[model samples]
Target: MGYMPTEMELIELGQNINMNLGGRVDFEDFVELMAPKLLAETAGMIGVKELKDAFKEFDMDGDGEITTEELRQAMNKLMGEHMSRREIDAIVKEADDNGDGTVDFEEFVRMMSR
Candidate 1:
């Protein structure tokens, strides 16, 4: 069987993605927004459609947006681990556009498909 990724490796992977996204607001807002660095360490190295579907899954309220709480819960449920509240807030703040305190589909796509 393949080896499991360590927690530090996971955090580094997240940081790499966040960095490559350049803290953008949306994919259509500018060039290279979707040019995010892909990490092979992630589960099966998913594609854009799978990534978007994952984002939709995170939007548990079906509100077309993912709040920090929703992201936190999704992480816990899917990854079987709890993320710190601060980490969740940081992630939301990183992708939040229009300052609405949430990541919309555009932002989510831009962040993930990067």
Candidate 2:
């Protein structure tokens, strides 16, 4: 899944830009300003929300975080195989950017993005 801002989002952004600029921006200037701004906003949003949601599903304890055991169960269910502890450990280690021995939403997102 991906985050594509709706048409309404774009319209609201344009309205915001117009308001901030006192509604005096010419067409060419508006395009110049909005093009890069929209690109940056969308780029930042891409796959971030989806990855968070995916992490939530793996976080079976409802603790807003995922341990290797939780990930093992989730992957076992998804892949229909009893994955070894070493395999699960490798997955968590790769995703655990902070070396805190667990995967948080940010870590999960970063791993999925890669």
Candidate 3:
């Protein structure tokens, strides 16, 4: 891992980014500010095969895409965290670039890589 940022550092970065954006921090703004650091720290840490495996784990029913129900079940089973439908919907919204209401392999890869 390359220089994982401390909590304080992350707070400071978020504050700075928020200030730069006129006190408004949208999702894109947040992602733009943090993506570089995140990419740097995780670069080469995960390979394509691992990503595929992860995607498959979430993509229950071998459907080639992760539906909200699949994600919810996966989270509950794998992480023991019972997430609400709204929470799962928000996650899918963030990762589903195609707006198909599901996370495909490519979208999952992009989300993880980011």
Candidate 4:
């Protein structure tokens, strides 16, 4: 069953863009890929207080920091219903200019801006 992306698979998947998922997914068979895992299945959402609060859910380390992994987790939770990993990664990269793997709260807030 397809599950958490391996580091290598993540790299390979990141190399190409899937237009269907809005240039986020690379899998030629995302449906087959996500089927058994049921990654795409969800009930619904209630309310999103703010983007920062949404981000905090994955900031396990706290310290007002959010890493790519954390961001991915959050993206999966908040945006999984709409976007794919590649799109999420691209958006995350916009804020993580240093590519240090962490986005402080200030950076987090700044990055989500238009």
- Which structure among the candidates has the greatest lDDT? 3
- Superposed model 3: Cα runs more than 4 Å off: 1-45
lDDT of 4: 0.56
How many clashes (backbone N, Cα, C below 3 Å) per candidate? 1, 0, 0, 1
- Of the two candidates 2 and 4, the one with more favorable TM-score, higher being better, is 2
Work out candidate 3's RMSD over C-alphas.
Answer: 8.1
Total backbone collisions, model 1: 1
Sort all candidates by lDDT, best to worst. 3, 2, 1, 4
User: What TM-score do all the candidates reach, one by one?
Assistant: 0.57, 0.57, 0.61, 0.42
- In terms of lDDT, the poorest run of 10 residues in model 4 is 39-48
Identify the runs in model 1 with alpha carbons over 4 angstroms from their true place: 1-48
Write down the RMSD of candidate 1 (Cα, Å): 12.1
For each of the candidates, the C-alpha root-mean-square deviation to the true structure, in angstroms, is 12.1, 9.7, 8.1, 15.4
Where is model 2 more than 4 Å wrong at Cα? 1-48
lDDT of each: 0.69, 0.74, 0.81, 0.56
In angstroms, give how far residue 7 of model 4 lies from its true place. Answer: 52
Q: What pairs collide in candidate 2?
A: none
Q: Which ten residues in a row have the lowest lDDT in candidate 3?
A: 35-44
